[model samples]
Target: MQDEEQDRPLLGRTVGITAERKAAEIGAALPRRGAEVRDGAAMHTVPVPQDGELRTATESVLAAPVDRVVVVTGAGFRGWLEAAEHHGLADRLVEQLTGAELLARGAKARGAIRGAGLVESWTSPAEESAEVLERLLAEDLRGQRIAVQLHGEPMRAFRDALAEAGAEVLPVRVYRWTDPEDLSALDALIDEIIAGRIDALPLTSAPAAANLLGRAERTGRGEQLRGALREGVFLACVGPVTAAPIAAAELPYAMPDRARTGALVRLVADRFARD
Candidate 1:
């Protein structure tokens, strides 16, 4: 029994996941590697209520030729195009986008652009929005119309920067993040983390990380959670973007070289094996 346990590094360990989209997928992977899984989706993702807002933005983008288009996430980019198709504007939108410079924030975004039969002018080397913004700011963008596809949340700073640079900004909000329908599971996971029962946590998105920390603060367990994290709770983030909130909290976390979910799972397994 001891020898077999040695072969499975994650055996007997518990890992908590807070992503709603692929919680089941990630949860299954952890158990296969011998770790117990706890699924507590911190937030839920819903398509932007098609209440004309998205259509209005689409129409605006098609109103004139855009100088640049920013793709922030693969799913969001795909969703935006689908929404456009529903409004009978997908083909036109794609044609307009093809004429402009496309900036992809990461590999997934790049893939989405290519899948749409469009090529990105450049992809951020760090897969960070900050890097994307930096690249745009370095250019002269006055009087340029730019469209930015938003993921689950608004990129206020990124949009503001472009607008300040004298460019007309059109934000395409494909989806929005909302609190989970059921808070019980998330609350229970919070309890487990505070009690140090969860050995590690694997976070896939920045919204999930922020939502987790926000929930802890709301429940008056923020300090306790921070203490537990500092004391030795392992945090495995998919990438730096997902680690931002945790990093701002001055907590330590490990990130995979690549930002894919599979890489994140492998990172967790490798860390436990090393320990």
Candidate 2:
């Protein structure tokens, strides 16, 4: 019994998960380390490949030659191409993008661009949208037609900043983040967090973190949730981008040196084991 407990570092710990796409994978991983996993997907990714909004955006991009293109996320960039292919504009769209200066926000986006046979002229070292914006702002973007691939939500501020810099910005929203179909699980998870029943909460994306915080605020337990997080519950974020919301709320969190899910899992296990 003593040996088993030593091997299972998280034997007495309960961890909450807020990922929709990778929930099963993460849930399975935590249990292997002896954690009681609580699954509560806070947001859902709704693909808009065939939607009118995406089509219109695609059309606008193809209407004229774009001078620059910003790839924000790998999935979003891939989905945008898939949507273009659905509209029979894949070949032409690819040709047009190939001629433009491509800027990838991170490694994932860079990989997606390379997979599509497109080369990125620049890649952000920090893997942040803010860094992408800063790079664009440094250049004189007067009269430049730029297309920005949005990930899961509209980046109004990002687009607005570009427009302010005298560039015509076109936003391609390949998908949007919506509340999960069932809120019971998420609500229950929130309750558990507020009551300090959960030891740690792991977040995979910015939208999920934002949605969780938004839900708590809507239920008038925002302060309670923040207090609980500050007092007892350990918050683990996958990466800096995913940790933005928590930072905005003035909450402390732990992030792995690498942004991969496996690294995140190890970070959680090691943290608990050390504690």
Candidate 3:
């Protein structure tokens, strides 16, 4: 059975994975079906610099139980726990959140919350943060204290919206998705993509896709790269969020109906098999 499975269609194809947090796991999944994974880690996850900003937020949450807590991303949720652990307050923070109404932007955040032994009071449909805020606004939120786990990008609009609805919002920005500190290998990967050296690319986040294109654009090879993607190279994104930039660029790509890692991989495998 193992040998038969190893003889799968992707046996000699090269797949590029640009995920950061679970880069290894994504890469590992590709090989089981026989695809060689190229490490295209354009971004790295880093806890918000040891600056007191993150600590202060966690402290505030513990000081007074927030009326409602909104978790934006799984990565952000995990990052918060990690940062709190550094301050020896992970357990306390988790305990403190028990009394608050927890909301998740998507399944990812819900997963993180559950992993921490916390239950989410609700989750937004379509995994959109805006939907979560909109749903909360329909109800009475006057004087409600809400804590939001920010995921890298600035969501001033989200904060402002909550405030307009009469909710005091406290943003707990735990970590950011930043470009890799070292650019030594990025150029090579771009070159390979242009040269058609890679067969497929799996993007797990919008930022990673944007960063990859930004780097290519800086090198004056953006058009060529896009052409490559449109012509032969397969670009597979985890979901609509990750596919948004690719779509905006007018590039052709494939994505599964559900934004899950396994589905993304299967979509890629199916694409390769058809070709």
Give TM-scores for every candidate, taking all chains together and pairing residue i with residue i.
0.88, 0.87, 0.78
Question: Whole-model Cα lDDT per candidate?
Answer: 0.89, 0.90, 0.83
Candidate 2 residues 1-275, lDDT tens each? 87766688899999999999889889999999999998889999999758699999998999999999999989889999998888899999999999999999889999999999999999988677778999999999999999999888576778999999999999998998899887899999999999889999988889999999999999898999999999898899987778889999999999987677888898888888886
- Which residue segments of model 1 deviate by more than 4 Å? 1-7, 124-131, 164-166
Error of 1 at 92 (Å): 2.8
- Give lDDT tens digits, candidate 1, residues 177-262: 98887789999999999998999899988888998999999999999988988786899988776888899999999988877788
Candidate 2: worst 10 consecutive residues by lDDT?
A: 1-10
Return the clash pairs for model 3, or none: none
Please state the error at residue 274 of candidate 3 in Å: 2.3
| Model 2 alpha-carbon drift over 4 Å, by segment | 1-7
* Model 2, C-alpha of 14: deviation from truth (Å): 1.0
- Please state the error at residue 232 of candidate 1 in Å: 2.8
Clashing residue pair totals per candidate (backbone < 3 A): 0, 0, 0
In candidate 2, position 256 carries an lDDT of 84
1 versus 3: better lDDT goes to = 1
For all predictions, the C-alpha RMSD in Å is: 2.5, 2.6, 4.0
